[model samples]
Each structure stands twice: as structure tokens, then as C-alpha cells.
Target: MKTARAAWRRLEPVHGMIYFVPEARRRYADLGLRGRAGYFASRSAAFGRASAELVISTFYNFNPDFVRQAVDGAWDAASPHQVLDARYAAVGEALRRAGIHELPNLNEVLALTRRAAEAACEHPQGRPLFAAHAALPWPDDPVLQLWHAQTLLREFRGDGHVACLLSEGVGGLEALVLHAATGEVPVGLLKSSRAWPEEEWADTEERLRERGLLDGDSLSSDGVLLRQHIEDRTDLLTLPAYGVLGDADCERLAELASPFGRAVVEAGLLKLG
Candidate 1:
């Protein structure tokens, strides 16, 4: 059982629960739970035409009894505690406009979204909010770009393309060194750099070595991996905050960077400089 569970965990995407929000809302409402009704409504509204079917499905799933109570205002005299369910439903409806759809089983999604919303609310300065929005591309906030970059690095771990890219930029070198310290680089490569000139390459190498790019000898075990990570991240850096990349701009930037840009393309990274 434990092995099966572990396998399942590995197979599941990081935020799988959120993906089924629309279905979860319907299931709960059908069972007479009003706690998330309003929430689902609000989410539906936010998603607009993209998720209209999901929103309507949630509405029809609402408990008939709860619907009646709401229409008749029978719970108006109830204490706050007694009326909490209604409050949640109302709030959910408001949030529906913000793209929070009903999921198939929302316990996890609710917990996740609630925490995110709370954090966003606390900041209210728009930066955190924007970050939250941007986080939609990943499973969760913590995973963001770095996690994606690492995943790409792992996919192309031994490719020479990654190594060549790391050899190019000071920033890339620094990032590789950092990965080395974390054991994300390969150890053998760290041992090979010894033949290179100490005086000419000393400063940059020392800086990267300090950051853990180099071990006692060649590139650290993580050097190649980190190089790949940096290359992947560099491609992302040129992308818009919303994650869109313009082909024309990419072409122009690539042209400007010339061989460097072509190298990025060959590495299968973004075409933009």
C-alpha cells in the first residue's frame, strides 16, 4: 500500500486538486453543502466564457433546501455561527468572478486557494497578487520558475548544449556554481577545469567555485545540471510577465545576440536573447 501510494504521488501533478475545482463544487452542493456555493459562483464569473459550463453545473448542484433558505431569508435571524454556511456561499459567489471555479473535490483546492487568497489579501499591494496570478502556470507558488527550470535541466542533464551555454555568461556561470553547491551539478566535470589557466580564469572561476560551481577539481557534480537550469531560466527571462513570447521580438533579439541567440535555439531554449 505504501509503495502504491508513493507511486501515485510521483505520478500526480503538484496541484492536481485545483484542476478539478469545477467538479468538486458540484459534488458538494449536490450533497447539500452551501459552504462553497458562493465561492464557486464567484470563480465561474472570473473565468468568464472560458468556464461557463463549470459555473452553471455548480449552481444546479446546489442543495434545494439551501436554495430555498437563501431565497426566503429564513436564516436572517440566525447567529453568525449558524449563518456561516451562507456567508461562505455568498463569498464564493463573489469570488466566482475572479476565476475560482468549482472543482470535483475541492478540499485540497479550497485549502490551497484560501491560503493564497489570504496572503494576497494581506499584501494588497498588487505585487503579491500579480505573483499569485502568475503562479497559475505552475502547481503552486513555491514551485514557480525555478522548479520548471530544474525540471528542464533534469531532462537535458548530460547534453553538451547545456555545458556550452554555461561557458558563455557570467550570470550563467554563477548560477551553475550555485547549483553545484546544492549537488545539482555533475562531479566529474568539476575535476576537468584544472588544465585551464589559473591567472586568466582565476577570478571568474574563483567566484563560481566559491558559489559551489567547482569542487576540489573539475566542475562540481551539479555543474552541468545547473548550467541547463540557467539556460532554461534565461529563455524564460525574456518572456513577458504573462509568459507570452512574441515571435518577431524573439527573432529580432536572436538576431541581435547572433551566435549566442542561435546557440540558445540549438540548445532548445527560447529563441529570444
Candidate 2:
């Protein structure tokens, strides 16, 4: 088990994700009855909607009640699921029209999620686990949810600048952070957990430094300037679902939130109330 975990850790990306299949299969094959019992007990429902709801519920569990209320308010303002369905349908249809083979069905989505979760259990990382539950028909990959949650948490804590450099997207926690902290896009720091030659690390460091984001093992002056921008851009008072003011505030927030809320829901980051 130790050998397998070490290998998996070495293979996993430092700032990205990994799904270690072979290691997972090996671990599952070695589990005793007690381990099996716990595994099945936790994952038996990783085939549907109930599981998805449970995952979302867990995310809301961490916040103050008012935060949850605010999230609910925001959710109510948007036509939840409609935009998601449209997006999914569009993607599916485009794939079909393009004659793409091996497109995932509901069963495949569930199975893939289960496989990933099983891998996670075998080589557990500190990250949260999500899987497709019985009630949801969509791709309820827990890893994706974990990423979303991590992104949100980082954003809430004013650490979203890193996220912006990690992916190409709109207003991701990282993007928001970078936007607020620096008035420009941040360059990525290419440091993988897997060992690479020192030359590669040196090259990466040089590139990042040249971009004015890093300065010899630290953020450069430009990076500092960016952080200032992030501080000014974000509003801490806007809760997840609820608005800052009373009725009037809620109304105004709802109007402003409708589009973004729909986008988030469509991305499957949040659920409809």
C-alpha cells in the first residue's frame, strides 16, 4: 500500500488533477473485510442524483446560516437547471453531429465517477470526494465538485489569484483574485510534484520571472500590484445565495446575480434551491 501510494503521489500533478486507476485497483484488491465494508458503505450510492444533492448539501454545511440563505436567494433568482440542460444538450448534440465516438452515456458517467472515487479511496489525498449519485443523471464527478469547492473557498479567502493562472475561464476564483490583486493575467508556476530535471524547473522559474509575476522565489513588485487590484474588486458582503441589504437589497442583488448565478448553476458548481 505504501509503495502504491508513493508511486501515485509521484505521478499526480502538483497544481492539477490525476486519476490513478492502476493504483486504485491494486488497493481495492488488498482491502480486508472491514475496509471493504467502509468503502461500500460510503460509495454504494455513487450512481445518481441523491448523491449529488448530498455533495452540494455538504458544501453549504460549512457556512453561517445567513450565507446559506443568501445562496438560496441567489439560486431562486436564476432559472436553475434550464441553462445547464441547454449547455449539456448543446455539447451532446455537437458531439453527435461531429460524429464523435465513445461519447459518455448516463451509465458511463456514473461508472467513470465510481472508478475515480475508488481510485481516490485506494490512494487517498486530502481533497474532498464526490461521485455520481442515484438521483442525478449528469456527470456527478466528485473531483470536479471538489475543484469547484476549492476554487470558491480560495476566492472567499482572497487567494483566488492562483486559480486564474491555472486555467482559462471566466471569473474563476483565481481569475477574480488575480483581477483584484493585479490588473492583468497572472502566469502559471509550473511546479509538478513528479520529479523533473532541474533544468526544467530553472527554465520555468525564469519564464515566470520574465513575466513579472515572480521574483526569485517570491511574488515580484508587479505581483504585489496585482494583489492590490484583487483587494479592491471583490465584495465580501455578498453571500452565496442571499443579498447584503434587506428586501430592496435582495431585489437589486437578484437582478444583478441572475446571469452569473445561471452561469454557475449551468457549470454545475451550485444547485437550484
Candidate 3:
């Protein structure tokens, strides 16, 4: 089986940058959005008729008020499909301009991705994040299909992660704290991106430390094991999709996707390093 981290890394570079890259942000701005709030407001509007709270809670997994601030202004500006299509076009254009799409075997990678998605079983109930996305109409072009598939795969694992976290009694802030403690994400970035206040975050850190999950500023041995368990469970949960690809195909997909992923990183799209 592919390691959980490896699977995430291979796909992260492809779709991870949509929210952070200058290209997508500029696209949202061109569509009359203000900043990060506007981008989340516009892009997430694709889930038609869903409340901002639902998007915030289920999809973005960020602070409720932070998401609400964005949706308040974004709802009336454009329909969900319009914002989604525009964002896709703009981001895809950026990739093309950067020659990411020009990579050899581009079609092969997309084809393998789509095949895996098609073979995957339908999203189960209770996974609102995955179910919401799985319900969307498929795009016609291979590029869009690749993006959509990646998006679905992400939500698939995301919903599973949420469930796992909940079962472990880890709420949003604690989840972010744990991730930061493990060095999965930088603490400053997590705090800023999640709109978490300093005092509240410090409190959460204290609680984690008290729980034996943290030792001072870093994760303890138990903390690392817990995180690894969650990740392993997440990988197992996502196996339904990738299992369809089989080990050989999964490895092949990674190999084919690596170059394009590297280009995105080189363009400073994904904030991985």
C-alpha cells in the first residue's frame, strides 16, 4: 500500500495551490472579490444552496466567523457554477502559462486519475464534504476532469479525517494545534490561516500539553503516534478509491504526476517548503 504521506504529497501540489497561488487569487480579484475571504466565498459557492456555516464546518474546516465574513459579500455576486468555472479557467490558464500543462504525458496522468475516480465507489452518507462534491456534474475536458477528480479524492479523505478527529475528541483548534505540533504545518501559518486568536490558541496548546500530547513546543512520542494513527486510518479510508488503481497503477500515477507537481512547486504555487 502507498504510504499515507506519499499519497497526500503526490496530489497536494496539483490542487493545493488554488487557494494560495497568486494566479487564483488574481482570478478572484478580477471577478470583484476582495482577498482570501472573497476567494473562499466565491470558490466554495460551487456547492449550491449550502449555507456558509456548512461550508465552513464541513469543507474548509476553518473558523466559522472567518468563513461567514467572506460569504456575506460573495453570495449575491455570482452563482456557484459561474464562480467555479471562472476559477477553474483562470487557474488552468495560469498553469498553462507556466507551462505546467505542457509536461509530456499530461494526458496519461489525467487519464489514470480519471480511471481511478471512476472505479471508486460512491461517497457514503455522513460524509457531507465528500458527498457534496461527489454530486457535482463531471466536467468534459480532461484537464477539468483531472481537477475535479483530485478535488473529490481530497474531500473523500478530508471527510474521513474529520470523522477520525471527532472520534478522537479533537475539535478544530485542537486539530490545528496537533498538526502544528507535528510540524505538518507551521504554527504561525495555522494560526493566521484559521483566524485563531493568540490567547485561545495558547489555551489550546496548554490543554494539549496537559493531555500529554505536547511537551513544551513540540509533539511528544504519544502525540506522534496518535497523529500517525489518524493518518493511517485516513489512508485506509481512502483506499477504496486508490485501491481501484492497484499498486502498480498507483505508483505509475505518482511517477507521471511528479513532474507536473514539481513544476507547480517550482512556480511557488504549493507552500510545501
Candidate 4:
């Protein structure tokens, strides 16, 4: 239902900003990370002691070679768990330093978010990818539970999006290209972050142009439709989790969460972009 999508839109700004917040990234660097490369390498490594390729291919949905290149020597510098711990600690520190108060009714938000997220595990049909994380014991701390719930919902939607993208023949840079076309992500940052060769990036753009999904520097009408289709499907896939609360509750959750997210944004700790 539209309410599910509406609720997700409201919650997204809060749960998703951690990845883009400058302070969080700075925290990783402070912990001895080597820049953007080390940040991705370490953060994505949180799932466990896995190869960079596997993490990229699974969690990041990026080219394995690119991730491998970025993580070439990161692990030797710091273990995965150490990096993961630092990332979490940094987020908390960043929030504190920003003076961004916790969400009002923190306990209520935590209870609601956790319950809805955990419900997804009960009937994870078509969402088997969430099984590992879903099975993890819930944290006792309300803030930690909130974080865990956010992570689970994110992965649940992400894995489904990846499956849909693959079916549409969009992988790695191509998927990034389409995402940039949507006007949400800046092309330059995506290009640099994915570590794609200039020529390869240009070639992909040309290919997309030929497919009528792109114009000189923007998505064509068809491109917009294609992107919308992908997004609509992604939203639909997330219904299994959001549905646990029903439409009214979903809106209530979103309403309760928006202020907390706004506080972080207002504090300049997180950027909507």
C-alpha cells in the first residue's frame, strides 16, 4: 500500500544517513582506516571474516575487483570485528558530538521498530537472505535494538533490490549508473566510489544511451519509468516487514521517527543527499 512506501520514505532518512554522514566516516579514519576504501572494506566486513570479493558481491552489490582493490591491505591493518566495533562506536560518538538528542519516546520507537523487524523473520518467504541477521539474538539495549532493526530492514530490501536488478540485467556499475540516473546519487561520487575506469564508465553511459534509458546528462522518459519500476518493486518487496504493523501503524512509526531523523539532519551530522 502507499502507506508502506510513505512510511519507508520517512524512516529512510534516519536509518540510511549513517552511511553518508561525514562524521561517521571521519570516525573510521580516526580509528586508523585508510580513507573511503578502508571505510567500505571495514564496514562491509561486519558480516564476518569473509573475503573482500564476497562482501562486495553480496552486501555491497559492487564489482568484486573494485572491492578487492580497495581492501587490498585493510584487514592486515585491522581485524574485521575491530573495524565493525569502531564503526558502531563512531556512530554513537558522532551523534553525541552533534548534540543530536535521541528520538522522543525512544523506548516506544525501539519496541515498535524491533517488533516489526522481527516479524519479518517469522515469514521470510522470498527473503531467505535475511535469515542470518534475523537469527541473531536481539540486543537488550534499546538503541542497539533500533540499530539492529534498521540494519535488518535495510538488508532485506537491498537483497531483494539486487535480485530485481539482476533480473533486469543491471549489475555493478550498470546498477550504479541507473541509480545515479534517478538523481538521488551524484554521478561523480558514485564513479569514484565504485572505482570504475573512466572509459568503462563512459562506455556504460553510451550503452545506456543506446538503450534509450539516458540522454546527454539525464534519464529520458523511458529511463524514468524503468527506474520507477525498479523502485516500486523494491517497495513492494519490503511489504513483508512493514505489513506487520499495518498501514496505520506504519504511518505512526514514520511520524514518530521523522523528528529524530530531522534532529540529526538539523545538527548537520547527516545529509539527506
Against the true structure, what is every candidate's RMSD? 23.2, 21.9, 2.2, 2.8
Q: 1-273, model 3: which lDDT tens digit per residue? A: 464336446866677667766666666676777666556765466577456787777754577777778777675665677677677876677566557657798788787777766555364566776776677788776666777777777777788889898888888888898889877667888888788778988999999999999999899988998888887887888877788777777888887787877887787776522
TM-score of 2: 0.25
The lDDT of each candidate is 0.34, 0.31, 0.73, 0.70
Candidate 4 stretches greater than 4 Å from native: 21-23, 26-31, 60-63, 98-101, 123-132, 271-273
Ranking by lDDT: 3, 4, 1, 2
lDDT of 3: 0.73
> In model 2, which range of ten residues has the least summed lDDT?
11-20
Clashes of each: 45, 25, 0, 0
* Candidate 4: residue 129 Cα off by (Å): 6.7
**Which candidate should be chosen as best, given TM-score against the real structure?**
3
Q: What would the C-alpha RMSD of candidate 2 be, to one decimal place?
A: 21.9
Please give the range of 10 consecutive residues that has the lowest summed lDDT in model 4. Answer: 94-103
Please list all clashing residue pairs in model 3, or write none if there are none: none
User: Model 1 residue 161 lDDT?
Assistant: 31
lDDT tens readout by residue for model 2, 1-273: 222222112212210111112222233333321222212222322322223343333322112232223233222222224323332333333223322222223233223223333332332122232222212343444333322322222223222222223332222222322332342433232112122345644665566567676666666787676554444333221122122133443343234323332333333322211
